[model samples]
Target: MNGESKIKINMKAPLKERKFWDVIVIGGGASGMMAAGTAAKRGKSVLLLEKNSTLGKKLLITGGGRCNVTNNKKDTRTLLSEYKGNDKFLFSAFSKFSVEDTLNFFNSRGVKTKEENEGRIFPASNKAEDIFNVLYKYLGESNVTIQSDSPVVSVTKEKEGEYFVVKVKKGETVFAKACVIATGGVARPETGSTGEGFTWLEKLGHTVIAPDLALIPIALKDKWPKKLSGLTLPDIKITTFLDDIKQEVHKGKILFTHVGLTGPTILNMSRDIGELLKYGSVKMEIDLFPHLDHGALRAQLQRLLVEQSNKKLKNVLSILIPGSVVGPLLELASIDGETFAHSVKTEDRKKLVDQMKSIFLSVKGLLSEDKAVVSSGGVELKEVNFKTMESRVVPQLYLIGDVLNVDRPSGGYSLQLCWTTGFVAGSNC
Candidate 1:
C-alpha cells in the first residue's frame, strides 16, 4: 500500500515476446484495467500496456488519496442524469454494467466500501492503494499480461490480416485481434494523461473533441483568498453571477488556495464556471454560514459577541468563523481587529455580518488542465456505440474512460464511467 508496490501480474514473458493477443488494452488506467481484466475473465488473452513505471499513478492521488471508487446513485435514471448532456448516450452503457455491478464486483473481491457525503464510495480503509490493489489483483487473477514502462507509440490495423498492430516506444510490435484505447485525456499531465490516445483516434478517423478543463479550481480576482490558503470551509453556499445577472447556486466544501478556490463545490461547478468565463466575467458570493439567514446570523453573532464583550473583535468573531480568517476578513470589511466587542458600532457590526454573509469575489479564471480532476473532451459520443463501446469509424477499436467525450462531475462519477464503458467494451470487443 505504500511506495511503488510490485505488480504480481503473472505475465508469461516480456510483452513483445508474445506472438498474438486476443485483446490489447493500450492504457493501464482504471478503465484499461477493467477492460483487460474483464476480457481475460472471458478466456481471452489480454495485454495491458502502461506508460508509467507502475500502474494507477493518477489513481493514487485521486480523492486526495482516498480514491472515491464509485457514486451510489444506483438507479439508472438518477445515475445517468449526473452525466449532464451525456445521459442519453450513456443509458445503454449503464444498463449493461450498472453502478450496482461495480459495487458488487469490488465487494466480491473483499474490498469493503463506505459511503460518504454526496454518495461518494471509498474503500473502508480510506486508501487509494486498496482500489488499485483490487484491480491489479483482478488482472493477476485473470492472468492479464502487463507491460509497464512501455509507452505505446502507435496503433494501426493490418490491411490484409485485419489484425491491429501496436508499436511500443522501444521498437517492439505486438498484434491483437481487437484494441481498446483507455488512454485518458489531458488532465493531470503528471499522471501520464498526455492524450496520445486522442491523436491515435483522430488518425483512425474518429472525431475528437478539443480537450478542455473540467472539475477544476477557480482562480479569484481578489488576493485575500491567498491569505487563507489551505483553509477548508465546509457547508458554504456560493451564488454565481455573470454580468451581475444571477446564474447558478451551489453548496458544499471549498478549499482556499494561493491563487483560487478548490474542493468539491468549486470542482463540481468549475465546468459551468469555465463556460461562463467564455462569455464575460463571473462573480461569486460566498456565504460563510449557509444554514442561517441574515437576521439569524446577526443574532447569533450578537450573542457570541455579548458573551465575550471585553474581548477583541477579532477574538470574538473567531467563535463565529475560522480563527485564521478573522484578520484578513476583518481587514476586508474595514473593521479594526483590535476594537473591543462592546465598543464596536452598530454599523460596523452590520458591515462585518454583511461581509461574512456575502464575501464577494470575481472569477479570474479556471485553473489549467494540470489542476483538473477530469477533462471535458475526447472521442465524440455519437460516433461510438454505447451498447458495446465500439468506435463506429474504426472496426474492432473501442474507446473508454476519459478518451471519450463524456463531461461528468467529480465524486466517483468519472470512475463509474470507466467501469461501465470498460466492461461494455470488454463484453463486445
Candidate 2:
C-alpha cells in the first residue's frame, strides 16, 4: 500500500479498542524505540506508545541535530566512570549491551558512525535524522506496533498473574505480559519529557529520587560575565571552591556566558557545584594559562612588556590574550589601558601577572532545569536490577534512560546510557 492508503486505513481503524501485547513499551523516545525493536526481533509482540505526535522528538534535537549516538569507549570500567550517581548499578547492563554493541546496532542498520574527539560517536552523515530514521525503519521491519498521541495514564499490576494493565488518557487500556518504562526525565519539556514517567513509577510503589538539573550552565554573581559572553578560551583550568576549600578542578575549554561560565570545563564541574550549593556559597577560579607556572607566566608577561615597551599596556596584552579580553584584563589588573608599558609600576606588573594566572569568579547558582542538557537525580539504581533493568519490587517491569539516577559528562555518555539500558531491557523483555 502507498503512504496515503496506509493513512486512510489508520484513520478508519476504530479508537479506544482493547489490545494485548507481549511487551508494551511506554514513551517512544530513544530507550522505548530500542526496547520495542529488540523485543519484537526476539519474536515477542511489542507495542510502542508515544505521547507526542511523532517519535524521537528528543533524539532529533540531540547533539545540535547531529546526534551523538554513543561513546566510542569499549571498556565498561572507563565508560561507567563517566556516570556520576549510579555507576556501579550499570555493571551488568553495560556488560550485556556494551558501547561496542551500540555501535554495531546502528552500523548494521545502515546508520554509519564515526568517532570524534574525546570518544564521542556521531553519524558520519552529521545528521540526527539519520539515526532516527534507522530506528524507525528497524521498528517497522521488526513488526512493532507504534501509536502516537497515546499518553499512558497509569500501569497496574494484576495480583493473580505476571500481567499488567496500562491505562491511557482516554480510558483506553492495553494489557501486556511485561512493560518497560523508558520514559525520559524532566529535562527537555519541549521534547515531551515532563517527569510523567516518575509519577507513573511512583504510582506503582517505586521510590523515585527527586530529579534535579544537571549539565546546565552556572549563573555567576559577578556582572563581568555578561560582558565576556560568547568569548571562548582553550586549555583553561576551572577550580571549584566551597568555604575557601578547593572542592574540584577540571581542565578544558571554558566559555563565558551571559550569566556565568560554560563549556566542557564548567560542565564537568557543575555536578560538584550542585552538590556543594546545598551547603553554602561556591566560588570558582579559572586559570587561563594552566600549563604555565606563576613564575613562568610572570616572566612571559615581563618579556612581552619589555619587547613592546613603546606600545600601550592594553596593546601589549592583545598579543598574549584575545583582543576582546584586553580591556577586562587591564581592568582586573587595576592598570589604565592607555598607560605605556615602559611606565608600568612594579606593583601593577605583579597584579597583571596574578590576573593572567588566576581569573576569579563567583557562582550564585545553576541555570534553570529547562536549559539543562540532562537531568541528574531520578529513580535510584538500587531498586532495579542492572542486568535486565527490571524492577526488583515489581517483576517484569523495566526502567531505562534518564528516568534512572545517572548523569555523565557531555561527549555522548547520556545517550549511551539510553542505548545500553534500552538494549538490555528489550533483550530481556
Candidate 3:
C-alpha cells in the first residue's frame, strides 16, 4: 500500500488488545516518537503516550521555530565533547546512532536538512513544523499507537515477570514487556515537560539527580549593566570565574539581557556557572573587543578622539559604541561624560581602553528551571546501559532523552541526544 493508505490503516487500529505490547514508549516527544517508530518498524507492537494534547509542542518552538535537527559534525568524539555532563556515558549510543544516522533517518522520511554555522543543522525548508509532521507521518505509517493527553502518573513493576504496569491519571493501565521513558526534563513546562517522568523514575528505585537550569540566562547582582539590554556583541569572549579561579572561556555572540547576559557564548558557559553556583557566587567577564589587544584598543580610541577632539565626549563615543554603553564605559574609566575629547586625561584614556577590553558582571544566579533551555541534572548515567539505553537495575526498562543526566549545548545537541538514545533503545527493545 501507499504511504497515505498505510497511515490510515495504522491509525484505525483499535486501542483494545488482550496481549501486552512488545514496547510501550512514554512521553511522545522527540525521543518517544523515534523509539516508537523504530520499534514498530522492527515488527514489534508499540504504543506511545503523551501528556500534551499533541506531540512535538516543544519541538515546534526549537531553534527559533526552525528546529535545529542535528549538527553536521561526523566525528562521534566531537559530538560527545559538546555535551557538558555525562559525555563518556554516550559512547555506545553515539556509535549506534550518530549524526550521519540522524541525517539519513530524516532524509529517508522525506525531511531534508541543511547545516548552518558551527555545524548546526536546520530543516532545508526552515520550518520546525515540517520536521514534526514528517515524524508524525512516519509514526502513523508504522502503526505506532499514540495516545495524547494521557499523563502517566506512575509505573509499577510486576512481582513475577519482567513487565511494567504504567498507571495513568485517568485510571488507565498499560502492561508492556518493554518500556522506554522518553519524557524530557523540566526546561519548558508550557510544552508539557512538567518533570513528571523524573518523579516516576525516582519512585522506581532509581537515583534522580535534582534538575537545575543549565543553558539559561544569568541574572546579575548589580543592575547597571541592565541598561545595555538587547545589545548583541559578536566575536566576544566571555570568561566565567568562580572564587577568583577561571572555569570556562567561551567565544561567540553575547547578548545583554534586561537582567544580565545571554546568547551563544553566555549560554555555553552557563552550564559550568550552574555547577559552580551550587558552591558559591560566580563572576563573569566579557571582552567586548576580543580581536584587539589593549594597546590596539587604546590606539583606536586615541585615533577617534584625535578625529573628534572638538566634539563632546558623549558624541565622540557615540561613533564607537552604542549610546547606552557609552555612559557605563565612561563611568568605568572615571572620565567625565560631559568633557570634550581634547580635555580627556592620558590616564583616563588608558582606563577607558581597559574598560572596553573587559567588562565585568557578577552573576547572582540563573533563571528559573522553566526558563532554562535545557536542564542539567537527571537520572545518573552509571545506572543506565548506554549501549541499549536500558536500566541496569530494572530489566527491560529503557531511559532516553532529558530523563538522563546528559546535558549538551543549545545548538541541536540536546535533540540529537534524543534521536540517538531513542534509536538505540528501540533497536534493542
Backbone clashes in candidate 2 total 0
Model 3 C-alpha lDDT per residue in residues 1-429, reported as the tens digit of each score = 122333443432334553378888998888888889889989998988887767888888888689989988899998888785567889889999999999998898788788887888999989988778777887877888877778889887899957889876777688899999988998989998888888878888899999877888889997888889998887777787888788887889878888988876677777678789888778888787888999998898899999999998888888887788898888877789898999988988888878887888889988887667888789999999999999997889999998998878878998999999989998999
Q: What lDDT score belongs to each candidate, Candidate 1 first? A: 0.89, 0.84, 0.84
Candidate 2 residue 58 Cα shift, in angstroms, is: 2.5
Residue pairs clashing, model 3: none
Tally clashes: model 3: 0
Name the lDDT of candidate 1: 0.89
Give per-model TM-scores.
0.95, 0.88, 0.85
Q: Give, for candidate 2, the lowest lDDT window spanning 10 residues.
A: 1-10
Give per-residue CA lDDT, model 1, range 1-429, as digits (tens): 542356565443686478599999999899999999999999999899998887888888889999999999989899888888789899999998998999999889888999998999999989988888888888888898888888999999888748899999988899999999999989999999999998888988889999987889889999878889999998899999999999989999999999989998899998888899889989999999889988998898888788899999999988888988898889889999999988989898899889999988999999888888998899999999898999888888989999999988888999999999989998888
Q: Between candidates 1 and 3, which one is better according to TM-score?
A: 1
As for model 2, its CA RMSD to the true structure in angstroms is: 3.6
